[model samples]
Target chain A: MIIARVTGTVVATAKEPKLEGMKMLLLQPTDASGQTAKGSPVVAIDAVGAGLHDLVLYAAGSSARQTEITKDKPVDAVVMAIVDLIENQGGISYRKG
Target chain B: MIIARVTGTVVATAKEPKLEGMKMLLLQPTDASGQTAKGSPVVAIDAVGAGLHDLVLYAAGSSARQTEITKDKPVDAVVMAIVDLIENQGGISYRKG
Candidate 1:
């Protein structure tokens, strides 16, 4: 999963029935350099109680549907975890690494 | 979907087969108030060309696998669109609303 920071939230009164309780978020694309990219909103999931400004990792597709809250909710992306650190072969490029 | 901002992207030498050439972006979770939340990485499918600080929309699960580039990949999140604006019952709380 790509590292990201929380930006904002969205609300929709007119939507699908199964999507009632689902939490959707708007995401800005970014790279490892911590630079933003060109993109739009992402109706992502909030599984781990992510708040604004926190860096997080999100998932999508059928796996998103696999969540207990999102099952059959017409959802695609779901916030699965909150990142405290990130490390790799590069050795401690990011921490919380 | 919640509104989020793009933070960064990722590169992995070891990954799934169907994920070759797929663009993955890092996202930060946000609320309607434009606040960041807690979370981890979000390896999303990039459809629209979104840069840093740009808002984007992403999908997940089997639908992410439905993409031509991500078919059968182990990926779960995919960036589907770049949001220019977001409007709702609140009467344009967010713009580009």
Candidate 2:
């Protein structure tokens, strides 16, 4: 799993039928340094209810389909959990507002 | 999706019940350069029949569970397809033997 920040939502009108009710969000991968990682932002299926700026835990690969919302779907990434707090290296680095 | 080379197999006798009978393999992520990318090797469940040294296309996140072999399983990654040829950066970079 990777720590990411929800940046925005993705609006797609025409998609696979299985993805009709799934929420999609734009995510920026975050490293331990709390800086955005080197990569273009990824669009992920939102399994958990997370708002913009929320720190989330996301899974990639077949593991992503393990969620209730994504089961048997074509989603490549999914936000599984909304992070409450994070301790990086040694000290507490992030906490939900 | 990412292109990866199967490096080896993983044996886990004790694991989640959902993971029983799944073939797990070690994967080294490859970039467009055909070089191993920076990151620790990942253990992925093999949905397609892939052998050692085989270049395969793998999907991460909930999409991984979309395969017949990984449906509802706890696998995080899964090998989905074998690569026949790769045209990267406007050049034919790799061709399977």
- Best candidate according to lDDT: 2
Error of 2 at A51 (Å): 33
For candidate 2, give fnat to 2 decimals.
Answer: 0.23
Predictions in order: chain A TM-score: 0.80, 0.92
Question: Candidate 1: deviation at residue B50, Å?
Answer: 24
> Which residue segments of model 1 deviate by more than 4 Å?
A33-41, B1-97
Which stretches of model 2 miss by more than 4 angstroms? Answer: A1-97
For model 2, residues A1-97, the per-residue Cα lDDT tens digits are: 8888776654433334466667766677887544555554555788779988888988876677788887777667889999988888799888788
Tens digits of per-residue lDDT for model 1, A9-59: 665443444555656654554444334543444557688888776667777
- Which one wins on TM-score? 2
Instruction: Name the weakest run of 10 consecutive residues (lDDT summed) in model 2 chain A.
Output: A8-17
Task: At residue B51, give the lDDT of candidate 2.
Answer: 88
